[model samples]
Target: MQSTVNYLWHTDDLLGQGATASVYKARNKKSGELVAVKVFNTASYLRPREVQGREFEVLRKLNHPNIVKLFAVEETGNSRQKVLVMEYCSSGSLLSVLESPEHSFGLPEEEFLVVLRCVAAGMNHLRENGIVHRDIKPGNIMRLVGGEGQSIYKLTDFGAARELDDDEQFVSVYGTEEYLHPDMYERAVLRKPQQKAFGVTVDLWSTGVTLYHAATGSLPFVPFGGPRRNKEIMYRIITEKPAGAIAGTQKRENGPLEWSYTLPITCQLSMGLQSQLVPILANILEVEQAKCWGFDQFFAETSDILQRVVVHVFSLSQVVLHHIYIHVHNTVAIFLEAVYEQTSVAPQHQEYLFEGHCSVLKPNLSAKHIAHTTASSPLILFSIANETPKGLAFRDPALDIPKFVPKVDLQADYNTAKGVLGAGYQALRLARALLAGQELTLRGLHWFLEVLQATCKRTLEVTRVALLFLSSSLGTERLSDMAEVRGTQELRRATELRTQLRALAEVLSRCSHNITEAQMSMGHLSSELAKNRDQVHEDRSIQQIQCCLDKMYVTYKQFRKSRMRPGLGYNEEQIHKLDKVNFSHLAKRLLKVFQEECVQKYQASLVTHGKRMREVHDTRNHLRQVGYSVATCSTKAQEAQENLSKILDQLSHQLLQDRAEGAEASLLPVTPYPIPAPTDLVLHMQELYEEMKLVAFDLQDNNRIIEGLNRVPSAPDV
Candidate 1:
């Protein structure tokens, strides 16, 4: 490849190439600014001078953000070839992005939307300036990363573009074969003779094809053989089939063609977006020029879609209770306004937490930013203003009853009760076993007695604390009162509480008795072990300590209802509900009511809204079909009128010929026939188009209603 385009630009890298020109990434000699230089080949210059300069003129006239800007025109230093310096898009062409493995199925919904808006806006600008882009494909659209890290798509490669009015016609066939109109494809690719003139609607066809490829990662029409290999079959498919009737075809060797009409499951666009997109594709992808949508209608519909908000599921207390449809451009404050409308919680009182994030969303942050951060899960909104909203007032009647006893400090009680029995038993066991069968010296015996007395004192202190804890916690006053209540649930709870208290008290009493017996035997064991006279006292002390451990273990086993414990077994800290706040039962009741009032109602409303949205989608689709029928009828009607006029002219010419031959006397009087115009059919088509627009508007309005509903606040979790 050539290393330099001109003395002014160093063309070390080739960006892309087309039949007419090759684009290169170049740097200015003086400024060092990176730019793309489009250098036309000798064949391009061989075309008419007007055709060669049209792209430069078109780019110079356009100054829109969505359209690529032209910098300057220069001549290559080597061949003196024309070079167009244009804006360098750092992110490359959209076609390059789509070819990546991640986007093999299609551009993700967000990226696709960006392409849709940019292309629509750029084409709208072109229409306003009476310019037609004969070629509109992903390869011709460039992508740039904006300062805020957003993707911006811009229309580029306007070589096939030209200034053409709506009524004016051009016979030139120029565009990629797959995105070309059938008339253009027949003449340009298949090398077929053509007399049909192309209007601005041809651009619409290309735009639709481009959008379909962007959405689905494939062309709308394809045969067993590719477009180039089977050009005649491709032409037949484009002309014979209705728009969107068949998406693509697949066939095995010598097998029948399998046609797919619906988008594949791999398509990433949501059903809601697809519903809006399908009608637009249907109207613009029409093969017949008369049935296709004009740029004005196309702009109107696309702008409407861009303006509409994206729907996001909002969850409260981990339960999905609402769907928020706020525009991505809207700030968190505006989103809060929508939330307020649904939840009746003021903006100041609402705290929005995105999934996997602890920090609440800032009020000034854009919804688009939030969407990017929390793309994996629904946003969770907590209402700090209302614990309970109106119309969902519910209080457990059982909670109204006054507490019959003071609340127990569970942590304090559990700490006191933990080592009461275990410590006493350990002390007695150690003293008897370690000194067994050995005569203790006077000093050793004294030391053993002292340790025993200290152990006894500590055991008493712990026992006192444990007894106090049990008496305060397991009092019968509350349980007795609850048992007298008429409600079955209350009565059952009271019985359970009574049984637990009784079992605990019995075990503590037995363990305390055994400990007291063991303490008394410790003195006897000291005398016997010191004199080395008998093992009787040592065995008795061991037996008393063992009995205490056994009692504690049995009680623990009964409490746990499992045999997974070792040693003295496990002890669970009992939670005494001494106050009227029965949180466990109250939580269950509140959850039930919450389900009935909030979750279930929201679900029902969602179902209804979904049905309505589908209805509107169907209505828009029907309206598009009606518009197609009307356009076709109008075209036929105009053709018939033209044919009638020709017939009349031929008849008049024949009469003149006869008169010239001196046979006028033999001819009968002629009658003038009335011919109908296609004005009514055209009017009907306009009406249907208007109806489709109205349906689109209504669908947007309904989306707002579906995003929010009057309902209860989220119930607090226990």
Candidate 2:
């Protein structure tokens, strides 16, 4: 056990422990900065000094962006407690992330790719230095957290690293048993030192196994069987392959309760990604070491997919990087290989010589002075080459094609193709009409001409005046060659056919030019209609129209995909973006149809409301008239009653006067005044009562109609 009394480095905390070492989260007393001190467990590990020495030497010579840095080493106490101080990685090892049951399936495929690329880069660096990391697993890969959601992965644990001579291999086996290559197992089984030994290929196999474990929570070749598990795993490594295909199948039970929208199915890799990873695993896991890929071959084969990753390298820097384009994808390895071939600089020297700065522009040259430089900013250049030394514009031998080839304009090509399709369709329609003996309309002819003109403009722009002469000349030339063998009858038929073809071609060419302006006008109209439809405000009607449009877009995309074949030469990305045939026209039509439907429904409701409103108005008018008539009749009846009363009272008073002078009135005949009978007045009063009853009945009916109108709800406002 290591004693803490004489320790040079102050071990603040224990980070992790292994069979041979105990890694501590420590503080350097002199520097007063945090660091990771991996103390050797002297009692557990045999030849601890040898392992410690090898690690120290490997770490001392190796300095890479994707490899952990070694700060210092110390040996103290009677136990010879040796400690290797290294840069502290805040985020910890990749194994911790991969092993966490909570997030095992939640880990993203992109994160796996990132980790793989970093390890590959680091391995490539190590291989260039003639060193092999016998052990490569998730446990040895550290993650460095950075600002702005960026991270840097680094290869750690160089305890098993060994520098070898050219094509050298070690007879003794080392590293985690589960990750041991088949060749390592075979050699161990043979128990022979003269046989082919294990080399860098073993490390690659280990890397493959590590990736498999990280991607899926389970090991590809399960290591089981208590004490004999290691032995069984080794035997299986030599004999058995992983079950299922490259990425393996995913079970729902293996994942969290729910997956994030951005992630793919749990533990399942995309085909594009699998295409890159499968080969690496397949080759590295081969029984024959020679068949396995070197770092160069591995990187080149995977660059197309692996290069999709964007890494940010940052430090204390104020300079803003502008217009950086990363054109390098495993090109640095190619450059180094070229340098080793043409120049005296060793591959190891070239590695240190070409340490890259992310921001600065690398100059173009053959092979300039090479020196180490560090990244100054978190810049991921997609179209720039920073890994190559400045002024060394060495083209990668692996990349036969140009790096920055322009993408084909599939959208424009598709549009041009539609014109041809329209013409063919119109021509077919015309032919059918002729066969049916039907008269063609002017509009039909106009459409046929416009479509044909547009098609010809894009596809066949041959000179019209020259076409006739060329056609005749070609026919005549053919006839001259067959003149001696053929009779005049055949010659005449050939000449007629050629003449008809030439005439048709001439007519089409002329018509195309004549209708060019009309086609342009139609195209303009279509564009404007599309624009108007797009700008329409989104209401329920518009939303319904948009749903139709979305369906159309999806159908068009599927149709395009179905039509695409090997030799089509269409850019899939661009062609996918193009709308289907007459999509914009369809969109405009959809908007028009939906809007018209809404308006018609609204108008119908308004018309119905108008009818109801008129009924209410008429009922109101009748009620007012009835009220006026009733008031007028009532006043007339009162006046009649008053007049009758006055007449009766006058008669009574005159009679009294007559009684007082009864003798005077005896001579005069007692003729009564012509006054109407009381029966007549009673009849008039009865007629008035009947008329009031009728008026009341009409008023009550009108009031009921008004109440019904009030109860009906008005239509919703547009």
Candidate 3:
């Protein structure tokens, strides 16, 4: 054992207590590491094995960037007090950051992304592992900033996390009040409780709120006052909007424009940056977080780009990187053997460097010049073993097809270069409708599908071949690993990869189902292009476009109605964003087309029908909850009408007697019943109702007809 530390692990150093546990910064002399340990104040000592086993098992399987690392555990040891040894992130919790001088007023946008990246990575890791990190908040995050630029946040305290198999009902309130999803509160209030819990989306929604606070330097919905019940808290988070203008009032401080709203000290950024950030931020702050693209897509896209972008490939990665230049000359003998002794090189080759008989298999250069290799480049060598005199003329070695490349790497005697860099070989195709410059047709769509299938399949097959070769060599150890001074870590990669593949398959399937719709959109995009004999003019019109554009946008509602499959949830708009296809950014390109086409020929008439479609798409979700609540009012009204009919027969006889006794019929002054403001539940339904409306109204007329204008119109310059 090392020398004893001034503080001992979990010796109860007397820090203040929290709702769940008592915290202490302690030293583990055996490991010589300082760790912040929390010990739950258990009233009884029971099931020691069960407690220790679960914590160890879960911690050992967890691998996430934001989560705090678990080092060692002593559940029934050390004077029978349970203790968890963890990596001590020195900067403390995000709550501390909020209270510190560095925050000044609040966190910046860039810093917020960094925080979300870590936390989301953690949540995603758990989700992939089929685990739920129930308690997520600023207090749980340990922001580690040691030396300059040497910091990474960790999601700590998984004491509340649960495995999928546990089947624990979500009615148990476990998190901070400010960040709970309204659904959980509703589940709590249920007379018949449900264990059919929401998914990892809960943690994401909390993270978004945390970011909102970080951005505005205030709670997204600050409650009227203090420690709130779940009902009131959920009411606000569900009903209240983040206090701001529609986008934001952000602008540069010292530049031409100043911020209209109070800016955070940490964020002295300009409005331009905020505008760029809206797309992603909108997704994060979505009311139903489940609909946001899960972290799996993010990782998959990133991994795909990283692997595909390498300029060179080396078969033998085992070659020592640093010794390369000096060790290069050592392989000369083996190379020469392959070049001359066992090879067919004419003795006259040395005489005529510019040889009369040129073999395609031979290196393009003469034998006088040797092939070059560099530290950053792959080794390439080629030679023909065929002895036919006419071999040089028959085969062009440079044109060797990719499927013929060998996977094996020989030391030097004989070899072939594998994995050619095939660029500028995209099988670019346009839909038949696009090719025709008119309305979309089934024949055109069929051809487009075939092309897309061929391209994607080829890409996948080629990549799988490469990956298989890699797997055979690497044996799936790990692409890379990082070190923490003191902690136990697991790969957790298998889980993430599965989630990604499933998500990709889902996106592909969805696209395939509505491929025609997508084609129609693309067709309209093409009509926006002004065709010359040789090339398309850069300018075009959006409003006055092709018939396909009109069909795609104007008929989106009809198309969706026709194609609606029941499986995409009871309410499709609520569950999936895919209604009619939209390449949102690509539409900007078509917007430029608006300038070239005569507006009179194809000014896409503003389809006010969009307003009615909004109501159609959103009705079930918009009024479902409110309908349930107000059912009582509607029921009572019906009961009163029925009761009035029952009493009318007896009342008619009494009315005749009362007329003789006439009681002042002409009237007390009339008063109006004041209309009560809509309740929180009513308001939330409206907000969701409005959001769905926007998506509904976003449709375009893909069939618009465009005639080339004599002169181009000006577009918004951005």
Candidate number with greatest lDDT:
1
| TM-score, prediction 2 | 0.40
True lDDT of residue 427, candidate 2 = 26
Cα lDDT of all candidates, in order?
A: 0.58, 0.48, 0.38
Q: For every model shown, what is its TM-score relative to the native structure?
A: 0.47, 0.40, 0.36
Which is better, 2 or 3, measured by TM-score?
Answer: 2
Looking at candidate 2, the ten consecutive residues that score lowest on lDDT are 314-323
> Could you give candidate 3's per-residue lDDT for residues 1-718 as a string of tens digits?
1112223654445433555466677776565567766565654234355543455567778876677787666543444556666778777777766543234235643465566566656766777787766667777788887467755778877765667532333434456656655566445432236565665556655665565555544454443342253344435345343423112221222222111223332242223234333334445445554455454654453233223211111111111111111122234333333334322343222111111111122233332233333323323111111121111011111232132112211211011111111100100001111222221111222223333333334323322332232223221221121111112122233223323333433433332334333344444533432232123223233223333243334333333343434333446443223322232222323333432242222112112112212322232122222222222222332233233223322333333444457631321122244322224323433443343233222211100100010011221111
The C-alpha RMSD of each candidate to the native structure, in angstroms, is 42.6, 38.3, 41.6
Report the lDDT of model 1 for residue 610.
37
Better of 1 and 3 by TM-score: 1
Candidate 3, residue 628: the lDDT equals 24
Which tens-of-lDDT digit does each residue in 1-718 have in candidate 1? 4424332543557899888898988877767888888989988988999999999999999989999999888886678888898999999998888754335456777788999999999988998898999998889999999999999999999999999999999998899999999899989988889799999999888888888888876788776667677776677677876655535453443344454555655566755467668888888878887788888899988887888676553433222334455677789888778767766677765645443343356789987776542223445454433232121112222222222224333333222222222233323323332223121122223243344344444434444443444354332543343234323453455455445544544544554564465556655645644553243233343444454445544433332332233323123323233111232233234334434533344344334333423433343233323223222322332333333233333443554566689875444333243212234423433443344344333333332222221122331221
Local error of candidate 1 at residue 435 (angstroms): 64
Tens-digit lDDT track of model 2 for 660-703: 77643452233344323334534543554454344334434433
By the lDDT metric, which is better: model 1 or model 2?
1
Worst 10 residues of 3 by lDDT: 701-710
Badly placed stretches (over 4 Å) of model 2 are: 1-12, 48-52, 77-80, 186-196, 223-234, 242-265, 308-718
Q: Model 1, poorest ten-residue lDDT window? A: 709-718
- Residue 330, candidate 2: Cα error in Å is 16
